[model samples]
Target chain A: MSTRSLYVSADTPVHRLTARSKIGLATALSIAAFVFTTPIAVGIVLAVAFGALAWAGGLRNLRRVWFIVVALFVVGFVVWPAFTPARGPTVLATPLGSLSSYELRFALGRSFRIVSFIIIGLAFVSATSNEGIVRGLRSIGLPYAFCFAVGTALRLFPTFLSAADTVRQAQEARGLDLSAGNPIERVRGYVPLLVPVFVNAVRQVNDQSMALEARGFDTRGERTFHGKRPLAGRDWIALALATLIVVGTLVGRYGFGVGAL
Target chain B: MREVFTMWRDTRMILLVAVVAAVYAAILLPFKVFTILPGLTSVRPANAFPVVFGLMFGPAAAWGSAIGNLIADIFGGTFGPGSLGGFVGNFFFGFVGYKLWGNLGPLSSGEEPNMRSIRQVVEYVLIAVASSAMCAVIIAWVADLLGLVPFSVLAPIIMVNNTLAAAVLGPPLLYLTYPRIKDIGFLYPELLADEELSAAGASRRYVAAYGLLVVSLVWLGVGLLVGTGAAPGTLTVGLVGLVGFVLVLAFAIIGAERLSAILERAGARPAGRNR
Candidate 1:
């Protein structure tokens, strides 16, 4: 578990921006990343995105997602070419095989496209807390209750795994050997292991609801903030840069097309 | 503010469990176990995850499982309205278990499950297995009838697949609820502390000591009945799953009905007391 999911964070300028803005930035960049078939454009965009992420989330955290990045890249650049093979003009050659210009382009385009998606996703998850996200929604005049549920779901994700781990440990100590045996025997092992995890989960929620009810969670009153979460000057700069890059690239791709480029 | 933060953190732990289930359901099943099951082809953890979600988080959990499965299908390129049917079917699969616990009010006359009565244990297993089996079969059958999924490709697989999921995952999920429910706050107090682990729960522990006996009896029985293609074997496995589902439901119902009776006679009895 690299634990570098979209949820990890640092209170940098990028982190302080609105979650919706971050989401929009990623979505827009991903669309542009999809447009440019030239590896040169993708290479530039990836470099810029990587720099932004390193500044926002720390290079170390970005490095943690290398396996995921590599895996997806492999799926895009290698696995897909193998499956579909090249059908268009010749572009890249290898001793083992050669890629048609179109196949090579598709794979290269996809790799960069998805890379942008992942980087932006990582940025948003890293920067935003579910509370701030929910409050941000409320600030936009969205219903608070629905935002609360979504926020709660986001917050509880990690805790659920810990409980599941606890159940796995309990079964393992009892010599249940969940990891052993053939595939069928192994899957069968989960019944005993996961059942308990589910049990604990249900029980935990009931307790949580009771605790929340005690604390007047549902009372119709103005909510208060506990921690400092603020928008800073640098956050706006990152947003502006992301916007410029996205708009410029899209305009370049659409207006010029490949021949003009 | 600190108290509110701490409480939110605590609740996050519970949601984390759902996330774990979602991730495990997505990642683990695809790689080896789901893929390499020799006789079985394309047995998805996606459908059963909804069941597991229902068991864990009441009805609300099913929504996440459903959405998660839908998302996984989209990425995996297996999405269709047919799968959407499967999602709904899977929701009912969990509803079977949650329905048991939520049969009465939220809580009142919950009864503890004990294996002292073998007959009751048998009955419990049957209902749990049967409930989900019935749900799976009906959904597949209706979908086929309604032309949601083709009968040629999906109908048989759906029944066997759903039943396999229910039979395999449902029982243990139902059974494991006993020990953890107290800490989870599903019960009014510690239900399992006074009561010994049920025959099903303790069955794994005793397997070593009674290794031969269990192997000869249970495994041999599995071989004979399943090998011989007896309906009874299928029925037995199916029902056994419900054993826990039935027990949990029994407790939930009993607790709901008997809340006043029990609460009226509460901690007045003092500590170190058995219910």
Candidate 2:
């Protein structure tokens, strides 16, 4: 019955910020990460992202994605240098060509930029609940139906996953050999697993639609929500700080060339 | 495309959207550990869901697949700025197949969607390839623009991954479920028949849209090759790719709007049952 999500329950300020504000802050940090081209600037953003995740007690979840993070870092570091033009003094020689200091530095900056993106993404999801995501998006003027669908999907994700597992087990019990086939046949083995789940889903849709109509789901009017709260003063402060960081980074990069490679 | 927006008004369509999303994410989540490219994409048998569901559920599948992909990314630990591309890319992965099936194939004269006939099967494969390419170009272009992954590398990989899954799993799934869904009164065309009434008269426009889609895809493919193949940082190459990207968006939006006009006209007709 357990659902998969990245949200970590905590009482820290990072988690306490309204979902909308957190979304805004995460967006701002992401934009700044892309704008800054220097290793130093990108490193600062990465540090801030990591620090924020730690503050929210969401760092524990990093274990799940450590492989991806490490792989991205390694790929960025290696690939960018290979493509980059050799410039400045020679740092190393290879069969292909000599590596320059500038190429090495560019590689370092790109690696940090890529890693920063994942950190910011993890931080945002770790602090915001699925319901909060829907509410926040709704408050920002998305259509109610779309938001409802998104929230419903999040809730149903776990149910369906569990159902797929059950269907697979049942099929196995009935002597379905999923592993004893060519690649294409192995994929075809998914037919039984997929069909039953989809059929059950269609049946649920019919009943669910009836329930929705009975609850006046199609009615037009202002609707009230549970757990709705006004944006607090602390939310404003968080938003302002995020704005400042983004604006400052852009100004430093474009106006003064402080973060350029 | 018009139904993509109008379906929001129907409670059942909204519910279908949720169901599709849940099913897609459920199928996609287990494969998260098998990363073909970390933080970009993974080995995806679930890629077939979008095509089969799109053919069955229409616009609901488009929106649902988009949301489902986003959910997979969030839980799979791959959510990032590139997720914007993934959302749009997955939307079209579902959208293009449904939109093109009856408009461009042997079924273009308004035959019901099926996989029994050889011509119908060929048409299904073409639809799968076109949709897969559309998804790959959009995602790889965005990833390249963000400097995350090169188009030359990611585009071909995604195209093959998606097309293979769709070609392998799509027809059988459709054959199994299409008749049952139609019987249950949940088949998208029947369920939304009122809104899609003008579909008969709009075939030419649909063909035109498909043409523009093909042109844009070609433009993007050529531009990406030229941009990345020559001097890596050439200004003209960048401009070529940028222009190509803009044309793809422009043509896609224009085509959707044209189809939406058809729906608007259909809605203006007298409220009566034709079925």
Candidate 3:
């Protein structure tokens, strides 16, 4: 399995930003990407997202998500025209019957929107660690219980992956060729692999519950956490800029309908 | 609300949630990476999670499924603002599955399913189908509103994917795991509710099923009207209408049976006492 984190721990401006600010900015940019439906507006957002990724020294992470983006582009290319309710004058192609220029434009705009969303999202993940996410969520008024639960969940992800790997290996040793069979047979083959993992996982749960009880982990009160980075002025400025981009696009799209197809 | 908080307060329960979430994400991320439409949708074996986890872990499983989806999104490189919709929608998958399963019939005391009993098996299937439909409706509706994808395209795909995964993998796992965990002394969510609350819960599920029955019937009616009134080439609309009609009838019939079963059990008990 691939790793859970793509964080680079760089010292660039984007990495130095507080996790809360980065998360907020990612959310704002993603909303803007979804709201706007024009090529130019989405193209600009994509440019800004790429710029941030470069600043964070996390452009390397783009390699991981390229296939997904290409898939999105391809699927949208086919589906948008076939299902689009509108008919246009300009015919773009006759492959699989006639296609319209208008549908192609629609697909391009949608693809740009998707690309911008992924770029900003990956940039945020590349810059922030899991611990940083807990702190960020806690600082933003989320309950400590929620933060702890999510933090523990993030920490344990790799452990489960390792356990699954062990199970798969053991099954392979016993002649389970998951890839060699037809689709239905492969799906059936996964049962032996999964049942053992799930049963072992339940067994592990018993040990976990006991360990937690020994730690007195249920005591409820105000708790203290160390090593949380305070949001500085630059974080605020970054958030403000994100807000402006989002608001500007919303106005352009809805107030004047400038970005409508 | 109190049960939700209580589950959170228990450290062991919290640990269970974490472990379940981690396992779920580990299973989910691989499928998520190679997507039909990366950010919008995918063919997910990950869909099997809510039913299995919910049956095993209860409310914590709901929270775990939601958080796990977010983690999987990040790992799969599909994380975005749209994740908010995913969070809420995925939560319902577990919530509804566990709630409906525990209330509908006796299912071997939360340890293992009594697979020989056809009623229990039907209950499991009903929960899986209903949960998949609920998750699909909420997530796809939000995606449509966000302009992520058209509702017509997204909902059916998600519903089919989730249902297929759960139907294929859910029952045998339930049968296998129940015998091992039944004696573990941990508090299962089915044991959390009193008899009165469970009966009330069953009634509420019936109400939800009836509501879905009405909405789906209306959808079929509208589709038929448009199909007949419009040009002869609109055969697709008519077919879609027929499919909608069939799906809703299945839901209604199963739901009514469950309700009747609950009532019979209640009536068989001593007077003025909760089952």
lDDT of 1 by residue, B1-275 (tens): 01111212233333433443345344323323453223223454334444444444433444444434433332232223334454554444544443333222222123333222444244334434534453444344333333222222233455456555554554445455543543344432222122211212222322321231122124223322432345353443333323423433343222211211222355321233243
Interface RMSD of 3: 3.1
lDDT for each residue of candidate 2 in A17-87, tens digit (9 for 90 to 100): 98889888998898888998789988999999999888878787788788878888887887777557788
Selected candidate, larger TM-score, 2 vs 3: 2
Per-residue lDDT tens digits for candidate 2, residues B43-121, read 5678889988887788899899999988888887778898898898899888876667656634442334556667667
Q: Lowest-lDDT window of 10 residues in candidate 1 chain B?
A: B1-10
The parts of candidate 1 lying over 4 Å away from their true place are: A4-11, A16-21, A82-88, A91-98, A129-143, A219-246, A258-261, B1-47, B54-59, B66-275
Q: Tell me the tens digit of each residue's lDDT in model 1 across A47-118.
A: 766766776764554565565566655555763454344577888787988888767766666566556655
iRMS of candidate 1, Å: 9.4
Candidate numbers, best TM-score first, in rank order: 2, 3, 1
DockQ metric for all predictions: 0.08, 0.58, 0.47
Relative to the unseen true structure, what is the C-alpha lDDT of residue B94 in candidate 3, on a scale of 0 to 100?
73
lDDT scores of the candidates, listed in order: 0.46, 0.77, 0.67
- Candidates 2 and 3 compared by lDDT, better number: 2
- Which one wins on lDDT? 2
